[model samples]
Target: MLKFFPEEIEFKVPQVMKTTKWIKSISESNGYKLGELNYILCSDDYLLEVNKQYLDHDYYTDIITFDNSEEEDKLEGDVFVSVDRVRDNAESLNVPFETEFRRVLIHGLLHLMGYEDSTDELKLQMRAKEDECLMLF
Candidate 1:
């Protein structure tokens, strides 16, 4: 199951059915099954608090994913997205808000799939995969 909630914000994912279907397709195509995935949209401040409390990192980030899957081939996680950061990133990157927002959405999913961005090579690979998945959107 896939769900989206706005935390301390008044936002809705643009296309609920289409977006959910696309996300599931991405997971299945990547050899993983979609489990209980939740997306929480909130302000940067709200996410910053979560970062501090959960991650012990006192900084702002676009997305923070908590993978809670018990099976190897299934994905279950809570993906936290900062709407404020997404809007700012869209403006700074000269892309539409929707585009950047979708990127962030898939970025979290990719992370749940075991993709990492701790190094330049890994970051490049992650970006390429994100672009490929974005094209499917």
Candidate 2:
């Protein structure tokens, strides 16, 4: 199941239904099933606390994925997204907010699919996958 909640934002997603279907399809196409995927939208401060508590990092990021998948082919996790970061990143990247928003969502999904972005090589591959996935929209 896919669910979305606002942890620190007071709002509703415009195209939630469509986005959910797209995420589900992305999982299925990668030979996996989506299970209990939750998206929490929050502010930078809220996410910063989460990062410091869970990841022990003092930096801000667009999205943080807490993986809960037990097997290789099943994707399950909590993806926390910072709206503040998304807005800033979109502006910095010179792209529309909706476009960068979708990119961040898929970026989290790609991580759940066993794609890493730690090393330069892996980051490039991950970016390629993200770009490929974005074209599906």
Candidate 3:
């Protein structure tokens, strides 16, 4: 089961369709019998605050995933995505909003799946995994 929380925040993201597609693909690719997953799309300021508070990072980022699952096969997490950053990155990368947004969503899920991007080599591997996952969409 997949759900959106709070029920108040209006998700006007144009890439929502693609994001859903990508999420499903990730779940399948990881061989996880997916359970409930939640997504919260917010502004850059909101995500930056989350990053600083939980991650101790003062910089803004595209997305953050909080895994709540008790087992690897049950994919459950709260994914906080910055729609504002997605838009900015889309413009900077010369890609469509849906493409960049999907990329960010996959990036977050990969983190939940124990993939790290803190180092240059790891970032490359993560990007490769992202591309592989993106191909499933």
Candidate 4:
């Protein structure tokens, strides 16, 4: 199941058509069955606060994933996305809003699948996997 929890603020996200498809594809490709996936769209301020509080980082980030997967076959997580950052990143990356938005969503799912981006090489691999997953959309 997939659930959306929009914050008090509203930001247009077109429709989550491709986003849903891409998420399912990524989860399946990683050999896990998705259970409950929660999406929270919030302002940059809210996400930044989460980053600082939970991650001990003071910088703004596009997305953060809180993995709650209990078993190898089950996939579960809370994907917190910053609509503000996504919009700006889309413009900077020269991609459509939906495309960049989906990228960030897949990035979070990748984390739940045990992918990391803490190092330069890992970030490159993660980006490659993200591109591969995006192409499947």
Candidate 5:
């Protein structure tokens, strides 16, 4: 199941039904099944606290994913998105909020699919994958 909630923020994902279906399709295309995936939208401060508490990091990020999947083919986790960061990133990147939002949304799922971006080459690959996935959306 996929769910979205607001934490310390009053916001709703636009075109929610379409978004959910798109996310599900992305997971299915990768040969994985969705299992209790939750997205929590929050402000930068809220996400910062979560980062400090859970990740031991003191920086703001667009999204944070905690993989909780026990089964091999099931994707389960909590994805916390910082709306403040997304909005700023959208403006900085000169893209629509919804577009950047979708990019970040799928970025978390890509991580669950075993894609990493710690290296320059991996980051390029991840960006290419994200672009391809955005086209699907």
Candidate 6:
């Protein structure tokens, strides 16, 4: 299951059903079944607080995912996204807002899929996989 929530923000997620289907395909294609996933869209300040309160990091990030997987065969997590950061990143990256937003959304899913970006090599792999997943949508 996937749920979307807005926290101190008014952003609306486009094509909910289509996006859910795409997320499921991403999970299944990666050899894991989809589980509960929550997307909390919020302002950058809210996300920064979450970063500090939950992750002990005092920085602004596009998305922060909390893994809640209980089974080896399933993917479950809460993905908190900063709409403010997304918009800024879109403008900085010179891409459409939806495009960058979707990428960040899937980037959280990728984290739930046991993908990491702690190193340069892992970041490269993650980006490549993100591109491939985006092509599917």
Task: Give the alpha carbon lDDT tens digit for every residue of 2-73 in model 3.
Answer: 655432346665555665766877787788756778878888888888999999999998888999888867
Query: Which parts of model 2 are misplaced by more than 4 Å?
Result: none
lDDT of 4 by residue, 22-132 (tens): 677778877889889998999999999999999999999889899998988888989999999999999998999888988888898889899999999999999999999
Q: State which candidate, 2 or 4, has the greater lDDT.
A: 2
Better of 3 and 6 by lDDT: 6
**80, model 4: CA deviation in Å?**
0.6
Q: lDDT for model 4, please.
A: 0.87
Model 2, 26-65: lDDT tens digits are 9999999998899899999999999999999999999999
Model 1 shows how many backbone clashes?
A: 0
Better of 2 and 5 by lDDT: 5
Clashing residue pairs found in predicted model 6: none
> What number of clashing residue pairs does each candidate have, in the order they appear?
0, 0, 0, 0, 0, 0
- Candidate 3: which stretches are off by over 4 Å? 5-9, 13-21
- Candidate 6 lDDT, tens digit per residue, 38-122? 9999999999999999999999999999999999989888999999999999999999998888899999999988889999999
The full ranking of all candidates by lDDT, starting with the best, is: 1, 5, 6, 2, 4, 3
Model 6 lDDT, residue 1, Cα: 85
Candidate 1 local lDDT, 48-82, one digit each (tens): 99999999999999999999999999999999999
> Which ranges of candidate 1 are over 4 A from the true structure?
none
Rank ordering of all candidates by TM-score, starting from the highest: 5, 1, 6, 2, 4, 3
The stretch of ten residues in a row with the least summed lDDT in candidate 5 is: 107-116
Q: Assess the local accuracy of residue 21 in candidate 6 as a C-alpha lDDT between 0 and 100.
A: 90
Q: How close is candidate 2 to the true structure, as a TM-score?
A: 0.96
Better of 3 and 5 by TM-score: 5
Better of 2 and 5 by TM-score: 5
Each candidate: RMSD: 0.6, 0.9, 2.3, 1.4, 0.6, 0.8
In candidate 5, stretches whose alpha carbon ends up further than 4 angstroms from where it belongs are none
TM-score of each candidate structure, all chains considered together: 0.98, 0.96, 0.86, 0.92, 0.98, 0.97
The TM-score measured for candidate 3 stands at 0.86
